[model samples]
Every structure is written in C-alpha cells, then in structure tokens.
Target chain A: MLKDEELDLLTGLLSEKYGYDFNNYARASLKRRVGRLMAIDRFPSFAELLHKVNHDAAYLPRMVQSLTVNVTEMFRDPSVFKTIRESVLPVLGTHPLIRIWHAGCSTGEEVYSMAILLEEANLLHRSLLYATDLNPMVIENIKKGIFPMSQMKVYSENYILSGGKKDFSRYYTAKYDWAKFDENLKSRMIVATHNLVSDRSFNEFQVIFCRNVLIYFDKTLQDHVLNLFDDSLEKLGFLVLGSKENLRFSSISKKYVQSDEKEKIWRKMK
Target chain B: MAKNEMNGFKVVAIGGSAGSLETILAIVQGLPKSPGAAIIIIVHRKNDLESILANLLSFKTHLVVKEVEDKDPIYPDHIYIAPPDYHLLIEDEHSFSLDSSEKVQFSRPSIDVAFESVAEVFAGRAIGILLSGANSDGAKGLLKIRESGGYTIVQNPATADMGYMPQQAINLGAAQHVLDADALVATLNGLF
Candidate 1:
C-alpha cells in the first residue's frame, strides 16, 4: 500500500517540477500508470520514480502520453455522425469556411471519419480539419492516414450505418494488410500535438470533437478541458462526444444544450 | 474510531461486477460512520438504466453516499458511486469526470479505467479494493496501485460472492490484504 506521504510526494513533484498536475485524477488509474512507469524504468520505489520524473524533462512527456487514454476508432458510435448529418451539417453548410477541431484525437481514425463525412456532405472543399493529440506516435499515424485492412470492413459498416452515401471501398486502397486512405481525404486534415491538461487553445472552431478523452481525466481536468473547448468554439458551435458521454454533470453542462441526447451531441447555448 | 494519522484523505477505490452488492453492503455496514477518506465505487453495467446502488448503499451506511457527477469534489466520509455506462476518472483537483468512450473490458464504468485513473491521480494515497467481479479487468489496475505504493485489498475468494476477481487480484501479487469481507472491514478500521 502506498503511504499518504508517497502520494503527496508524487503529486507535488509532478506539479512543482514537471507542471503535469495529476494531483486530482482518479487515484487508482494514477497509481497504475505510475507503477507501470516504475517497472519499465526499473525503479525500486515510487519515491525514486518521482525523483527521476521530476529531474528528467523527457520523462514527463512520455509519462503524460502513457497516462492519457488513446483508444479510438473511425465512425465510432455511428449514430453520432447520423445526428451530425441530420442536425448540425445544415447549419455548417451555411458557412463559407469551416474549421473543425478534433481534440485529443487518438490514432487518427476519428479524424479520417470526420473527413469522409465532410466529403460526402460536399463540405470538404470548404473545410479545414485540425486533429491534435498529446502522443506524437498517434499523430504520425494520422499523417499517414493508413489503417489495418482487416478493420476496414467494420469501419465501412459503421460509415454506412452513419448514413454514408458513397461506396466505402472507394475511400481506400488495400496494400497487403494496410488500407491507405485516399489522399484526397488526408489533404483536408492537419494533425498536431496539443495537451488538454497544460496547453493553451490555439484557434477558433465551428465544431470540436473531443470524444472519450475526458473520461481518463479526473473532474478538474475535465472542467479545464471543457472550458478550453468552450473558449475555442465559435458562438453556437457544435460539440460532439462519445456515445456514452454527456454534458449533464459537468459545471459547464448548463452552457451547452443537448442537440441529440441519444447521439451525445451538444450545441453551445447562445 | 481513531483518525488516520495521515493528513490527507486516504481513498479506497472499489471495483466490482457480479455479486458485488451484498459484499459491498457488508463491508460498508461494518465501517464506522466516518472513515478517514472518501470511498469511490465503480460498478460495471449496461448504459441505459438508472443506478440505485448509491441509494441502496446509503441505506446501509452512515457515510454520505451519492452518485458522482462531473467535478463533484472529493471529500472524506462520503461514498461516491460511478453512474452507469460512463468511466469515472479522478482529477488533479480531486473531482470526478465520466468518460463515455469505447468500453474497456467490454463494460462501461470499467474497473480498469477507474482503477487506472485513480492510480494516476492519487498514486500511493489511493487504496484499491477488488471484490466480486467475473473478469480480470481489475487485476492489472490493482497491480498498478500496488506499484505506486498504494495499499491494495482483495476479498478472500472463499469469502467473496464470486471468487474470480479477488482470486485474480491475488494471483497478480498486488493485494496487501486478502481477508474475508468481514475480516477485511475490521482490518481497514484498524489502519485508521
């Protein structure tokens, strides 16, 4: 069992020296991530791990990447995109230029999914998509726009269920086990690294998709990230989340009204 | 009950699935009106239903028991329950957030997600308790809490309503205490 002193020491070092501030994240998750780090680094104790993380600049970023939740897929929870097609796209169609931000985008699947949706809606030409994640490796994969061919059949099904009009196979070409998405889809997206915990928002967006990412963070981090999303969005902008997620419980929940309750889509309240 | 010598709250994060209610009630009823830290419960279930587990638990314990909301402040002497279909996570500011992402371990409000998030935020200050679950989801997470210097408690498989979860936790070599549900409560009380 970790003594209270050890917890304090770890949180203190993370904040004072590294500026990560995990002091309030769910305790069990934090302990496990730290433990994994300890075993990987071959440290004998939590104290030694803390000392090393505080002193080593590289360690903190790596730790942050490891701690953050990175699981995601294209056209996940298909109904969410269906709602976007039915409700939000009409409003977005009116804009001459649209900026969409996929915050905490993991593995780039969702980014491509959004691109394909915009293309089918005939809005791709007028849209600029920015996909950002804390992990560089995931961002690199986003740049490649390639996914496992084995997963493509399921993804195609999800796209169709999400109300896609095009032949899903037209979007990618299979190269052995990998499916490289059409370059046309990739061209509209710019992938980068932006930390929701510590980094500042860089641009205004008409739509922000930060799905399932906040669940990994504790309430305070969720609030902070939501606030950032609110600030980054244009007036009456759209906010979509993973299907199981909702804005009902957050401090900022009142600021956004449900656009589609079942789909987990919300729009900024005027 | 003597107060825990530690200044900060000593969190006990509990994760369970099948046959957890009875075991949880037994442990909760046995605890004092106030323990030194907050108790957070993550129970896996389908997305559509309302959770009465909090109310059920409130009926059995004197501690303040309620469902956790996003940014609900972490406080001592209370039991917070994770709502259905959302993974509950701890914040740097000691609050909670629910994530509706893809379910880990094929269940929303997964024990692993909750355990991993708490382990990340609290490190050693956290105590992980794995009770009656059917899967191995809590095993890796309990191991993580142990590695972070947090105390780990697992119900003795013989005493648990279901033996799999507690047994798996023990197999992982993460549990510090593997007593029966009744004995586990007394042991926890002794710690404070």
Candidate 2:
C-alpha cells in the first residue's frame, strides 16, 4: 500500500503532467479509480500508471474518460423538471430573450429535455440553451442528439411524470438500438467543451442547471465552482442542483435563497 | 484521521447491491435505539424518483432514517441512506460529501467508494458489513475496511438469496464473521 505522501506526489504530478487537477477531488474516490486501474489493467503500481499517463498520449484520454462520468438520463428526477416547468420557466419566459446554461450536460439528454420543456411552454422560439461539459466526447455526442433506444421507455415514463402533456415518444424516432431526437430541439442549443475547473464563465444566463456535477469536488473546489456560477448567473436567476447537492455552507449560500426547497431549486437574491 | 474521542467504534457503513434490502431491514430493525455510533447505508440505486428507501427502512428501525445530502452532519442513532446516482462519501468524521464520478462495479452509490471513505474516517474503530447481493461490488471495500483495522462481517453465503456478494467478500478473506440474518442482527446489537 502506498503512503499518503506518495498519493500526494502522484496527484500533484498528474496536474503538472496532464493539466487535470485531481488535488481537490475527494481523496478516497480518487484512490479507488486509480486502484481499480491497478487491479484490472495490471499497472502493478502507481509509478507504472503515472509513467503510462505521461508517456502515452492515447492513454491519457482513456484515463480521463474513465475518470470522468457521463451517467445521465432524460427528465431525470422528473420532479425537478416539474419545478422548472411550473415555476422557473414562467419567470424566464417573461424575459425578452431567455438564456439557459446546462453545465456538464452529458450526452445532452437533459438538454433536449429542457428544450422540449421550452418548446411545450412556447418559450423555445425565444430561448437559447447553452450546454457545456469538460468531456469533448460527450460534447460530440450532444451534437448528435441521439440516445440508446432502450432507455427511451424509461425516459418516456420520466417525461410523463415530469408533467409532459405531449406523448414522450414523439420527441424521438427510434431505429434498432438508437433514438434520434427531433432536430428542431437542437436549433436552440449550443454544445461545447467548457471545463468548469479551468475555464471562466462565458455568458451570464437566466438559469443554470449544473446538477450532479459539483459533488466530486473537495470543499475548496466546490466553493470555487459555486462562485463561478454566482458570477455567471443574472440577479434573481434560477440555479438547480443534483438531488443530494446543496449550497448550504458554500461561500455564496447567502446570495441564493432556496426557492423550491424540495426540488433543489434556488433563486439568486438581489 | 479525524479525532476519535468516542473510542473509534463510532461509525458503521453497510454496503450492498441486489437482494440485500430485506436483510438490511432486519439489521436496522434489530439494532438498539439511539446507538452511540452513526449508521450509514449505501445501496446501488439509479431511480430519479423520490427515494422511499429511507422511508421504508425507518418503518422497521427504531432510528430516524434520512436521505443523505452533501455536508450532512453525522449523528448518533440516525440512519443515513445514500440517494440514487450520487456516490456517498465522508468529508470528515463530522460530515459527508456526495459525488457524481464514474460508477464502479457498474453502479453508483458504490459500496467500495463509501466503505473506503468510512475506513479512512473511522479507522480501526469502524465496522463494515457486506450483505447479500448478486454482484461483487463490496468485496474489495470489505477488504479495505479490514485492512484499515476495522471489524468486518458478511452475511452467511449459504443463507443468502444472492450469495455472490457475501461469498466474494469471504473468499477475499474480508470477513471476521460470516453469520446468518439472526446471528448478524445479534452481532450488530452486541457491537454498538
């Protein structure tokens, strides 16, 4: 077993070598990911894995892919969407032009879900959804607007539960294993790779949906990203988070008041 | 690594995937009310639906069961259940953190992730239990708990609906006790 100092050296060198900062990630999870590679891939030791990451350019991308996740679904936690549809959407609809950001939008399922919600609410024509993630692979997938056909059943259920009035199946056309969503939804969305840790916030938006993305960070990094969101959000704009996530003790907690407490929805206080 | 004024046995993390809930209910029900230690539950779940696990478990247990939120304070006699999708982890001896990193063993709310964090915070004073499941998720985590000088247990494989999880932990030499449901309940009652 490696000592804590050795682990520190490895994580520090990873940032120096690859520009990915694992220093502020939760230590136990970082160890587990690295340890999994060791056991499954015959890395033998941290030194060997570090060497592979530094020497093999191809290996670095695969390592990053393994380290980052894209576990997402359409209308996930449908109640949160219901909160958006009933409360946030109406407020944003009053804006001359509504701008929304879906930070860490993996494979764009939820982005399309948002677009569908906007379309149904008659706000899609006036809204622009900016969906960004750190992973370029997922960004590319976002551009394609396709998902596994098998998941559409569950997604359809999620849609109906999220207060969808239209048939959920109408959003996508399925063939074999894949479902291609209606192209009209894509017109309102801009997909890009935006690393939350390294990049500055680009556009101030009316709502930011960075759900389930920040829980991986240590307290300091979590605060850092929260501040970034604070800078990017318009006053009285909405911010939604993952079910288990909260802004309770963060540096900017006082700046945002819990709007729909049960839904993890918050509104920036003026 | 946090200060352990309570003699190091202040945390218990139970890890399972499939076919383990019934046994979990029994253990939670059997444990004493207001036990000095904090009890944390980690199960593999993917539903975005409102969690009813804590609600269901609370009906059986004397303890108050609540779904975990990031930075939730650890409390004596309270049962904290991991919400779906996010991985539950300890921030320190005092609080917990949640993450959306890649799932391990093909599941989020990973047993290995939560168990490793518990081993770190509680060290030798902790207890880890691996129960019935079809998958091999908690095997390495149980090993980690034992290696960190904590006590460890697994449900007796012969009596398990899905014995593979307990069997894996036992095969890896992770368990100090391999007891049936009743015996398992008795052990927990005796421990904390």
Specify the highest-lDDT model's number.
Answer: 2
Residue B15, model 2: Cα distance from true site in angstroms: 3.4
Q: Which pairs clash (backbone N, Cα, C closer than 3 Å) in model 2?
A: B8-B125
Q: What is the lDDT of residue B144 in candidate 1?
A: 83
Interface RMSD of each: 5.3, 2.5
Model 2 chain A worst lDDT run, 10 consecutive residues: A27-36
DockQ each candidate and list the results: 0.20, 0.50
lDDT of 2 by residue, A103-189 (tens): 988788889999999999999999999999877777888888889998988998999999998888888898889999889999999
CAPRI verdict (incorrect, acceptable, medium, high) for model 1: incorrect
Q: Report the lDDT tens digits of candidate 1 across residue range B70-145.
A: 5567888889888875677775435776655557788877888788777766776788989887887788888888
Best by DockQ: 2
lDDT by residue for model 1 over A142-193, one digit each (tens)? 9898899999888988899899978899999999999999999988888888
* Per-residue C-alpha lDDT of model 2 across residues B73-190, encoded as one tens digit per residue: 8888889998887788887777788877667788777898888788877878789999988888988888988988889989999998889999999999999999998999898889
